[model samples]
Target: MLFRQVTHDDLGCASYLVGDDAAGIAAVIDPRFEIDVYLDLARYMGVRIEHILETHNHADHVSGHGRLALATGATIHVHRLAAPEYEHEPFDDGWELALGEVVVRALHTPGHRPEHTAFALVDRARGEQPWAVLSGDSLFVGDIARPDLAVDRVEGARGIFRSLHEQLLTLPDSCEVWPGHLGGSMCGGPGMDMKVSSTIGYERAHNPLLREPDVERFVARSLATLGPQPPNFEAIVSLNRGPLLATGVEATPLTPRQVELKKGEGALVVDVRTDQQFDEAHVPGAVCITSLSAGFGSRLAWIADREGEILLVGRDDDDALNAAKLATAVGIRRMAGFLHGGMTSWREEGRPVATIERLAIGDLPARAAAGELQIVDVRERREWDEGHIPGSVHTPYHDIDAIPAGIDPELPIAVLCASGQRAAVGASLLARHGAKHVLHVVGGGVGTWERAGLPIER
Candidate 1:
């Protein structure tokens, strides 16, 4: 049996490919919208993809079922209760999928979604015991699924509670459980423990959701605490209903000359790069928003207008594709296009640029000596207590939201974080909150400074 788990860090989704190499057939489960990865893997493994399966109508990230089936000539299988408005094969609960010696059986595990199902892989000859169960959204590794979903909203929580008791808790204790999501995804509740997958025995013993008997509390809390809506959800899922686009956005690439034209027109240019690279040099009016290449599309959707025609600047081919995906994801119908040759070509073509001031670890000593170094660490509380630069003020990034009333917003503040990501987010907040002087440390270089024997306000 050949099994591989593909995890996307940005969205925290876990997709699986289970195949029998000897049988020359395979099944892909819970894929993303990008179809190429699975195609390449199947080709490299010298096997044909025979089926595509989805555990539920996912809410966190877009699933790549349509494109996979279109490209691989594979059949899509879902639970009979789903009644998906697309072409698919409905498998009733207990239906079996056979691939040579490998067998996959579906268990109707409704709750997270009314039609949810978990697939259990069986090897009867190897033993009557099962090998692994793709728990889908029903059970997360360290967290049982939150009952809330989009359609039915709170009532769905009640459904999920019933599903857990009826379908999952009865599984063999030794069943190796593989869930569809991990930590950091909105689909699973925040109460989720920090792991991607765990055995039934481990979760049954440790997961608090399993401790509930009446199921009423489980339904109520899960309903009350659904995570932030998944970014670009409706549009992404809707994309599947149309003709499949090979690349997500399919926007035309623009030359440096073209990007310059957009900037001149006052378009908000975004250079999705690391802070160090962005600090080194950038197009004059661009901002860096760090996210996975493909997932960046959703982030872009948040900042840009629904029909905004904007310029995208990125480091490479994947970056450009991701930028386009962002445009498409957020329903931004118009993309003037991406910077054609990227920043390098822009500089080569004599396009003017700007540089963000970067501060080094050693610079802190000089600032401290001069008596105007007001450090504002924009990390979470857990991070703040972990150890921060001495004499620094703490303002967790997300919480930097509210401009604390009566506090001097005009004070010279240099936002610092573990790295540039949170720092950038903090700096942007300060800038928006009417702070006249806001700068962020290029990297959280305090640790380096301490390692070099610099004085810290212990």
Candidate 2:
């Protein structure tokens, strides 16, 4: 038996390659948009990828099953409830697929989505009993999947209750549980553990949601704990369900003049440089979403309109290519290519550049006291509720598409988050939304202020 888990930290998504070495056959579960990883893994393992198993039609990121199938001539398997347009073997409750001594049995766990399934793995060579379960979005390490993305919140929560109690819980306490997502994924609540894997016994004994015996109470609690849905979530789901979309091999390299024209024609110029590099200089009106951050793909998706074409400005060809691939992972595929030679080429051609003002947390107090800056707290609601600068306006970073009311474009606006990474994102969004005199509050955030003995309002 052989198994390997490929995780995309940016999206908190995991895909698995499970196979039988003797049979030289393997199956991939919940693949990401990039199929090369699986291809490389299969080649290295000396195995042929014969099956592509989708736990469900994903709503957060596009699946690579189509591309994997095209590359390997593999059979794609998905739950019938997905009604996917791509050719697939529609699987349901109790369906099983075998690879030599390794048997994968599907447990129809409909909770995160109506079509959600958990695959229990059995090594017949060792024993008939299953050893592990790939609880795709049906369960996380410490938290269960959020019951709101696919169906009505109430109905989905009810499904979650049943799926947890009747299906997953039925597994032996010793069975290893590998979830589809980890911490930082929007699919679950704040309690998702960063640890990669957990056993059924640990979760059953320690998970807060599992303690609720009453279905109504469980539904109410689940709905109450829901976080903001992933940006363009519905569109992502549609893309997954519709005809299979192929990943692009390369992005066209554009001259500075061509990039300008694309921008004029409604293309978004996304600068993927570091925050310091972007703050120093960038294309005028470009949005800064530094590829340095782990959540680069997600942040880009959050700010970019699904219909708009993205024009990437990277540090170099390699940087630009990586940025484009990350963008594709989140289903933002309408790329207009990248600026050749990056910002350096633009500067050589005497193209215009812009810079954002940097503000330190220590200086923030004086600015607020003098009414010289309007501090826009771009952290989450919970973060803001815990404590915030007295005069700061609570506006979550992802929701910074428009300049909220009472925000004066004339005044210098400082965008802030828990860390400067999100602050840079918010600052860029503010600039794109036509806010003049935007400031990227770097160095630190509200926590910095609090730690320095500055006053805050709860």
Candidate 3:
């Protein structure tokens, strides 16, 4: 038996390749939309991909099952309850798939989604006992999947409790547990360990959800920890369940003159550059969303109107291509093409550029003390609770579409997030929303401020 875990750190997703060497057949679980990674792995392992399995209809990122099945001639398997629009072999609880000496058994573990399933693997060559379980969105390293995403919070939490206790926890404590997502993913609550895999015994012992015995308590805890849902979540779910649009839509290169014209026509100019580079200079009215950032696609989808056209501004063609691919995964298909030579060319052509003032942590105290700067902490609610600048208003970056009711737009606003990246994005959004003077805190966030022995109000 051969096993490989492919992790997309930017999205906090994990896809698995389980191959039965004896049969030269493999199965991929929860693949991303970019199917090339699985294809490459199959070629290197000298195995034919015979099965593409989805634990459930994904809500966060687009699934690659359709693409992979097309590429490899593999049968796509999902739970019968999913009722996916695309062709699939629907399996029920206890259905087993044979792969030479290995057995893949399905356990209906619905909570994150009604049709969510966890695949238990039995290595017959080693023993009849199952070795590991692909817990999917059912479980994570140190946390369980968030139950509020699919149905009503209480109902979903009840389902999760039953699924964990009746199905997953029944597995032997020694069994290795692999989840569909890791830390930094919004699929689950915070406090997930960075490790991609854990033992059933470890999670059973340490996971807060698993430790709670009462269903009522579990439901309460689960509902309480619900964080921000992914942007375009409903659209993503529909896309994952329906026929996925074909990939490989190459971005058209637009000359500076064309880019300028498109901008005039209200095309959203998204500058996919580093926060520092974006802070230095960028096309006026462009949004900053670094292509490499985790949740880049989700963030872009959240901020930009789904119906609006997107015009990418990257360092070059490759960056633009990457940006487009990420955007498409989250169902952003209305790209107007990329700036031909990027910001450098735009500057060389004497295009108008805008710059945001970046302030270090040291500068924040004096300006804020003088009542000149109104700090807006754009981190999540949990991050704000951990510790934040005293007097700073908490407005999550995703909710920056409208300024909070109490915050006066005339105040010189300084936006800060965990790092400078989100702050840059928030600062740009504030500027677009008619804030007169916006400052991007480049080198400092709440973490930096706390580490610098600055006063923090928890």
Candidate 4:
């Protein structure tokens, strides 16, 4: 059996290319919206992609199954319970598919989603026993899939407990375990290991959820570890299950005047430059979302409307193109155009540019000592609870609109996250909302603050 795991570092998701060399046939599982990787792999491996499989209706990122099927003429398969609106072959429990010497068997593991399935690969050439299992969102290297995505928390947790213990744990200890996600993915708990793959024995011994056999205990622990779900999860799931849309929407170029007009007409202006470049000077009211950030698409999806028009602001056409592709991958399809020559052209044309103040980490002590600065920690709730600057307001970057209620716009406000990227985003939002004094903490975030032996509230 030939196997290759493709990792999307940005989203922390993994896709698979399993094939039989002799048979010249392959299968792709849980692919992202960008299908070029699978096509390129098939061309290089001297194999034909005949089957595209989806473990479940994903809530995080849009699936590429529809596009891959059209490109390779492969049949798309999903669990019968998913009831996907798209045309697909519905496989059920105990269903087995033969690809040359490798047999792909479907195990109905409905927890993360009601129709979630884990595929086991059996190499008939070696033995009847399975060699590995593609545990999609059902199990991870060190953590179990979060069950609250598709169903009620308690109900889904119970289902996940049964699915892991009965179907997955029953596999041979030596069988290799491949999951759908890794570290940085929101599909599971925060304790997920960075490794892309693991063995059944390794997970069985080290996985915290499996250590507790009691269903009640497992459910309680799973519930306690559940973090914030992706902001656009519901909309993403709806798009994944319904008819697939065009993914390669090329960004059109527009003059600064055109961009300004569109912004006035309610189009979202997304500035895809570095945090520093954006902070120095940018189009007023534009949201700062760097094109190179790993979570660029997800972050943009959380703030921008799915159906609203998006006007790209980048360094040049290449930057705009890349940003458009990233936005399309996450199902943000209503891109109007990109600024023709970017901010440089906007500034040269005598258009006004807005600037946000930057605060150095070293100077924070003096500002705090003065008791005049109001600091806002824009990290997640879990991170805030772990440790944060004392008296700092906890407002997540996605929920920056609430600043007016908890903070005074007239006071000097500073924002910080785990890193400086999110703080820049929050600062930009605050400035756009007419905050009198907004500071973007540059050098470092909570990590630097802690390392410097600064006092932490919690």
The candidate maximizing lDDT is 2
TM-score attained by model 4: 0.96
Task: Tell how far residue 257 is off in model 3, in angstroms.
Answer: 1.4
Candidate 4 clash figure, as a count = 0
| TM-score of decoy 1 | 0.76
Give the alpha-carbon lDDT of every model.
0.71, 0.89, 0.88, 0.89
lDDT by residue (tens digit), candidate 2, 7-60 = 999889989999998999999999898888999999999999999999988888
Q: Rank the candidates by lDDT, best first.
A: 2, 4, 3, 1
- Model 4 Cα lDDT, one tens digit per residue, 1-458: 88999988777899999989889999999988889999999999899999989999999888888888889889999988888888889989999989999999999998899999999999999999889999999999899899888889899999999999899999999999999999888888987988989999999999888999899999999988788888689988898889865356778999999999999999989999998899899999998989877888878887888889999999888888888888876778899899988888899999999888889887887888799799988898988888999888988888876455678989999998977889988888888778878899989898889999999978
RMSD of each: 5.4, 1.6, 1.7, 1.7
Q: What is the TM-score of candidate 2?
A: 0.96
Alpha-carbon lDDT of model 3: 0.88
Clashing pairs in 2: none
Over the stretch 125-145, how does candidate 1's per-residue lDDT look in tens digits?
Answer: 587667789999888876767
Cα error, residue 7 of model 2, in Å, equals 0.8
What's the distance in Å from true for residue 411, model 4? 2.1
Which of the two, 1 or 3, has more lDDT? Answer: 3
lDDT of each residue in 196-229, candidate 3, tens digit only: 7998998999998899999999998887777888
